[model samples]
Target: MRLFSLTILLAAVTALAGCNFKSVPEPQVSARDAEWLAQVPKAEEDIRYARYLMDDETGETPGTIVVDTKQRFLYYVLPDRKMIRYGVTVGDEAYGWTGTSRVARKAEWPNWNPPAEMKARWPHVHPMQGGPANPLGARALYLYEGNKDTLYRIHGTNEPEKIGLAVSSGCIRMRNIDVIDLYNRVDLNAKVIVR
Candidate 1:
C-alpha cells in the first residue's frame, strides 16, 4: 500500500508540472507616453545601485504605497504625502485581491517555491525553481503583517504586456526593469495599500 501511494504521488506531481503559459511583455508605442524601456539609456551600476530620475519631484510626498487595481498603478507615497505612480500587472480579477500591508523583505533573483495549496490546484504546473525563467523575475518585496508572512509578494515579472492586465494568481508584478527601479526607491518599512 505504501509503495502504491508513493508511486501515485510521484506520478501526480510529474503529471502536473509545467502547465502554465506565460509570455514576455512588449513595448507599446504611444506618442504621449514614450516607451519607458527605450527612454532609459544604459548605464553602469551594481544593479544594487541602479538609479532612476523621477518624472516629477517626490521630495514632498509621504512614504506610503498606493496600488489602484483599475488603473494598474502603484504609487510610492513621497515625503509630503503625494505619490509617484508606475504601471503594473496584478492578479487576475478572479484571483487577485485588495488590502494593506508592509514590505518587510526584499530579494534579488528571488527563489520560488509554489505553496502546497498552489501545487494541489494545478497538479501539472511547474515553473523554474529560480532563474531568469522564474515568474518572480529580478526582484521581490515580501509583504507581511506583524510577525507573519502573508505569502504574497510585490515582485518583478517578465510579462510587461501583462501590465494593466488582471492575470496573476495573486501577486503584484512589475516588469523586471521597473521593479528594479522601484526596489531602489523603497525602504524596508514602507506601507503598501492595494485597492
Candidate 2:
C-alpha cells in the first residue's frame, strides 16, 4: 500500500514538473538581415523606419513575402520560423488591393507610365523616364496574377516621406535603398501576399 502511494506521488510530481517546463522562444530576426536594414536611410529626418525581427508562426515557407497593410509592414519569411520585416507605404483604402500574387518581372530604375485614368486626372503628367525623379525610384517588382499583369507593383519611391503611411496610389512603396536590397533577395515568381 505504501509503495502504491509513493508511485502516485512520484507521478504527480513528474507531471507538475513537465507542466512547468517552457520551450524557448525562437529568434525573430537574424543579425545579417538586421545589418542590411541598418544601411537604409531613414524615411524622415527624425523618424527612421527600422526593420525588425519577429517570430512568425504563420506557416509561410521561407522566401514568401507577406504584406500587412494595416501595420505598414512587409515581412520576408525566413527559415526556422523567423521573419525579416521592412517598413512600407501602402495604398489608401480607396485604392488598396488585398490578394495573393507573384512577382512577374523586375527592373532597376523602372520607368513610370501613368495609367490613362491618371493621365486624365492630371493632364500635365506624362510617362516619365526611369531615373531618380521617377515615381518608381530605384527598383520595381511587377506583380502578376496568373500570368496576367495586375498593373500593381512593389517598387521604390522617390518620395521617401511616404514610407509607413497610407499614401500610395495602389502599390507597395519602399525607400530606394531598401527596395534595392529587396530586389536582390527576392526571386522571380516569388509568392506575395497582401493583406
Best by TM-score: 2
TM-score, cand. 1: 0.66
TM-score result, candidate 2: 0.75
CA lDDT of each prediction against the hidden true structure? 0.67, 0.78
Please provide, for model 1 over 146-165, each residue's C-alpha lDDT reduced to its tens digit, 9 standing for 90 to 100. Answer: 76888888887756557666
Candidate 2, residues 1-195, lDDT tens digits: the string is 999999988987687456432222323334543453354444552122545566774579888889999988888787888876778899999889999999999997778998886788679989888766778877899999999988889998878878899988789998766677678779999999999
Whole-model alpha-carbon lDDT for candidate 2: 0.78
Stretches of candidate 1 above 4 Å error? 1-61, 80-82
Which ten residues in a row are the worst by lDDT in model 2? 20-29
What TM-score would each prediction reach against the true structure? 0.66, 0.75
What are the runs in model 2 whose C-alpha is more than 4 Å off?
1-48
